[model samples]
Target: MTSPTSRRTVLTAALAAAAGAGTVASAASASAAPTSPAGSSAAPGALVDNRFWHTYTDWRCGTGDGTRVLPGPRPGVVIAVPAGRTDYTDPHTGRTAAWDYATWTSSVHRSAVPATEVIASWNARTPTGTWIQVELSGVYGDGTATPWFVMGRWAAGDGDIRRTSVDGQGDPHSSVWTDTFSVDDPASGVRLVSYRLRLTLYRTPGSRLTPTVWRVGAMASDVPDRFTVPASTPAPARELPVPRYSQNVHIGQYPEYDNGGEAWCSPTSSQMIIEHWGRRPTAEDLAWVKPGLPDPQVCHAARQTYDYQYEGCGNWPFNAAYAATYRDLNAVVTRLGSLTDVERLIRAGIPVITSQSFLKEELTGAGYGTAGHLMTVIGFTPDGDVVANDPASPDNDAVRRFYRRREFENIWLRTKRYDAAGKVRSGTGGVCYVYWPTRTTPGQQRVLRSLGLL
Candidate 1:
């Protein structure tokens, strides 16, 4: 095993070289395993059906719902890409297990530690061979963040895809070594998925480090065939100022209200995007919209005309909630349902505004506003600020504000239905809604700049 001190030395040297460059060296290759499909190294136990595919989180256990353990690898992990692949499967019922994407969360688990973090994944192609890809997105630690540090490794059968990978005999069942160290050796899907992932956060012997485990899968399989590789037509980049609009607004169960009785939660929010930001719908924007969602079975003619694309709480398609069970938040729920619809939107480079309605009514009553509503967050900010596109006032336009990070995340948690109660103890249903611009793509940025969203 490489000593902790040695690991820190390696990371520091790499980071020092990366300073000011805005880029980190990624693993040699990001290709999938290349074994001929299905020769069967060892079959995974059983693919169980799970419903959390819409949210994101760590430590997915393949039970009857979202995941199942295969026979060969006990407690192995699978990362699916190109968005619709199932990471785990049950041979019995053909049921696949998954986690919700919206709820997915990650942490190093070590307290006060700074070191390189590598996310490894194991994947298999049905029948014959399995392909696995691993990469390092960035180095995140106290007061430090970088989203561009990327590296990847891929091995196909006995032939290594990347020049940096170590050669394996049959299928990665141990006995592999790379240039870095013996531990960083590449292996096959059969062996990689067999063991629980270890949270390896490099730190000094006595530094306070928090341990973190990243959740990999989405509510559903929504990853693309290739990440790390730039899109063929890079979507234009436009930054919008998110708002804390309606943070004090209340919610009710009245039919008049849009988001679980909070009328302004979505429509009004959408209005802000158009009226203030000058974002209108384009042909592509209209392509993914879905109406009458976040409360399934309750369809409205108005929303269904456009594809709302977002499948998080109170979004569309999966928008069904009964007094009896959890809410459905998707227009199309093909597999494990936890991957949040917002994730898909962001990946597609669509700028969005999501709202969290407050439950103010009595628990026994049908409608009420418990907390604030109508806040917005854009793409993740390196500064940890809650990004927003507020239209309330010109001063607050398309700005990044450092709202109490913890508080802001907590509020979003409540809105996403991840929070059981308003204050964690006052348990009530929580839901979030997305407000997209009429236009899709950075072309919206062109329109916004012409209209001064700049």
Candidate 2:
């Protein structure tokens, strides 16, 4: 969980320049009201903003190298390039065998309204000895664009390859790396209008290593402070029997993946779902992981979904993408308006992964407070309380816990409140990671269609 204070610092800095120019106040006010369903008048807190995916363009390799598009993970194409030395010499080092790079840029996307923040995310698979890095920039009010900022350098399977200022990698073959960057102010007197992304692939010369990129996207929005309450009543509360998996039990199991259990909540909740669907990873999938662990698949999930920049496995989109790797599963990161929306998924037999934070007194049964945490909402209890598989518990057996309905809803849906620092910090705003059968049954399709997700 991210602390409210830290969130406030980032949000404040990002919106500061805009506020000074008196631009942010209007944008925020415009989006403060909610949007309504199609064919209906707008509701309170119903502002709608667009999020777009800008595909790669003008891909080219430096001298002595080549580039081509290859088949990528479902519906997406990958840019593949070979390892070779660049023709240009390094001015500082005066060396001829400098690292080579293949580059691609995304088309600029203009938002419907001025955006408060832009988040960039990507997925890639690289062989040993090769790596990928991403950079982002934005244009505000048709003025000069912000300088390109490095998102991160990533390689799968290698634990030492951290997302930092350091370039290149020692070895290859890691799982896909997905990370998000919140774009902040570039200059004063500029209202953000458009944004762009650049991806660079680097590898050792003659290493025969090729890296493949699956998908890259961005979400830009003026995150509202509140959401409209659903007009319909929630389904009667009833607890669903969900299996438990605790992060505490796995502590110290894999130091490479955020020192193991302490940070494994996201993957642990994901594992429970994978098992519920009867699609647990086979022995071969866990072969690379050291033996003797109770659920090696959880470890595999952690490694595959880990975000180098965030330095944790709790990224919402990354976790959803990881679950999609399994057959018969499709996942996405989205925000739900109310618990009724959650109940719809539950009735369809789909568990939801939600991000939330609360003070100890706010949520009973959970003894700690988190800046942010992920839990599986398996079902609701009779009387409309929450029945969740909370991986943050002390042990697997203790993972099942309940929370008062009103308290849980307030914490989950309306987390953007004043923090101890007297700054208004924003929460995820009811964000959820939902994984369902790629091929849904008629019943499932009905529920999804009702929610406008089908």
Candidate 3:
């Protein structure tokens, strides 16, 4: 549980007032600045900052049976709830609501970065049988709007679609969900001139469960030079001594969490970091997991971070938020500038979970092509090569692998690709998950200060 900070207090008060009046509160509107060409080739810059636009002041809301906007988990956050029952004909079971939905739509705005991709994210608190689906549409240079694309539908717990909890009871739990969609393909002449988002909330009838939403926002990015200049001498091959954990070892262990280990990369990497910090889950916490698992804690993480709507556990922000749920720990998902930036975190004894995609021949040692995969960047060799606990390895003994610094950097930074038909496809670029304890150690503080992130 998180301690009450000033932001949390303000958000709680705002939500309570809104809930009492059964009305939505307005928030200030935000807009992106005009786009400017990035600087010299040697010094690329961020196209979009990692801040969220939470003030729904200008957003429009709609509901089939009335709706209420409540407060979210933190300040600048709000929840959209559907009100009244949709099943008015069934007098005997009038409480059984019909198919009701509450929606919020954002005003369209042009990007200042000539964005090729847009990432939508949200934090949701949902009861059993409740879920949310998000869609995005982009306005092209021709002033034509792209068709609504389903980013993802999200709910807590496992399973391919939205359903009640495993035990047939409503479990009030929350998790963060994010999806990155392609908007502008350099090959295509259509540049995204403006974009808008729509969020729909759904719940089952006879269930009073209401879904809550927070931090709904989007980030845009333009392609950067994949091969930026490396350090003059490769920062003295420094690698933090961390434990190696493998996801392959747990394959077929839990069917509910994507048939076990094959898709457990994100949670597995997160579990490794949590254990490295000496904050393993207690027996009581893992009590819900089935028995006979070698590491119940890992299974617990897999279950907690699993995304029902996405049918995968690799949601970027969800894994980071899962780490934050632990006492004295905090985490965030963001994009890093370069390998040198990653080194700063390693030097501070922090392990970073990074997303990457590669064909079998593209990356040495790893004989596979994954549209997306997560691994822990633990350290660097004396020659500046990367040393990572790659969970995609075939077995536990092969989990730790080394790669050429340039090769690893290329795969990590540049994830966009094209098909034979000349269509664009990609994952989130230069994305990473950073987890740190709330009470920072001296080493952690030094690294944070040097990076100007503290």
Candidate 4:
């Protein structure tokens, strides 16, 4: 399996550069203290800083061209008037169609931490024939400017245009790998000092329907270079009753999506969380799958989240975007500081889907080495070992297993590692997807807030 290559591991050139990049921005508010939420015990701050713009004030402050803000509890931006109509050819379908479009560009956001990498995530409602594109342009620590990068072109469904991540986008200083913006080399110590996000809303010509974007933001981080991170103390042992689904079970399924289920760890893990939240694709959603498949939901998730450019289902933000497609659910791709942050989430009934790369010997009982792999961290054992719903299992039943805590954390949280060939490789550096309901309970909201997620 090529790339066992999760998001940033698919390419060889500068793949190791992925390790040094940092991730999240808080257009909302940065939690300078982990103790902001009463009773929280995480470290001073998560390694990442998140800045999400979902409030009415944030939209009003942006430079809008034919776009306006919708006010209320869940305010968003929508097309006030067509800035213009343009013809766009769907790369996947080769169908050229005219669309009415509008845009909003955010004010510059200086990173609380000089970030070596940044990942952008958004929550929006795009109806049929309406979609949105998110882009980022930043100034490097050296005061040099970066071009605006197309982070994603997305619609809730694939009928209009295939939701995708733009490839071959970068500069002398940095590059966009799948969905993450990474500095060319973190060793250079040249980081992104500030940045702005631009949102372009599109709709079929003559249609009043417009995409409403609820949130658009970036995560910026500068995890120190380390092959092994300091060990985190475990919280009270507890396990969330998360469902398990193995990607191995869907082998040879849909050849169109990344040559089938063999590379669908991202979506398979996403489906598990969707179901754990009491949400699942309807029979209509699974109708496209061949009848008699054991877990049609996983297959459905894979297709819905596929990125045509990457030719794989492992695009990090794409998976989070797909999970948010479910009713009332909200998802974002962000990095957690440590397992202690995860424990705080577990106490709040949240399960984290983490990205990491490891050798067969690095993680006990994994029995496999991957340049990159995704697994669901469901709970902790009494002794603080990990209980995970790993999608790489032989079967769904075997998806749940335990691994030594020290080994798991080192493998999952480290930014650098030695590959099976004894070559230097990049690790995910604690990258993860956190999903929850929009109308979260006060306690859940508190936990998310404490983590700088709200």
lDDT of 4 by residue, 94-187 (tens): 8888899988877777667778999999888889989888888787866777767788988878999999877677778888887888887889
Instruction: Tell me, by TM-score, which candidate is best.
Output: 4
lDDT minimum window of 10 residues, candidate 1: 320-329
Model 1: per-residue Cα lDDT over 99-180, one tens digit each: 1111111222221111111223222221112222222222221223322221212221112111122122111121211111
lDDT of 2 by residue, 1-454 (tens): 2312232233222212111110000111112212211221113343323332312221221111244555323333333554334442322234444345566555554555455544454556566655666555566564554545454555554432443321121111111112333323323333455655556666666555656654554545444546323343558765555678888877877776676765888888888887777787778778998878876777888887676545577766566656755665666565566788788888878888888766666677788776677888999887788889988887778888887667777778773654445556656667667777656788888875554343
Number of clashing pairs per prediction, in order: 136, 23, 4, 16
On lDDT, the stronger of 2 and 4 is 4
lDDT of 2: 0.57
**Rank ordering of all candidates by TM-score, starting from the highest:** 4, 2, 3, 1
lDDT of 1: 0.24
TM-score of 4: 0.90
TM-score of each: 0.25, 0.68, 0.64, 0.90
**Segments in model 1 whose C-alpha atoms lie over 4 Å from true places:** 1-238, 241-262, 270-348, 352-374, 379-382, 390-402, 414-454
Model 1 — TM-score against the truth? 0.25
Cα lDDT tens digits for candidate 3, 86-105: 33122222344344555665
Candidate 1 RMSD computed on C-alpha atoms after optimal superposition onto the true structure: 22.0
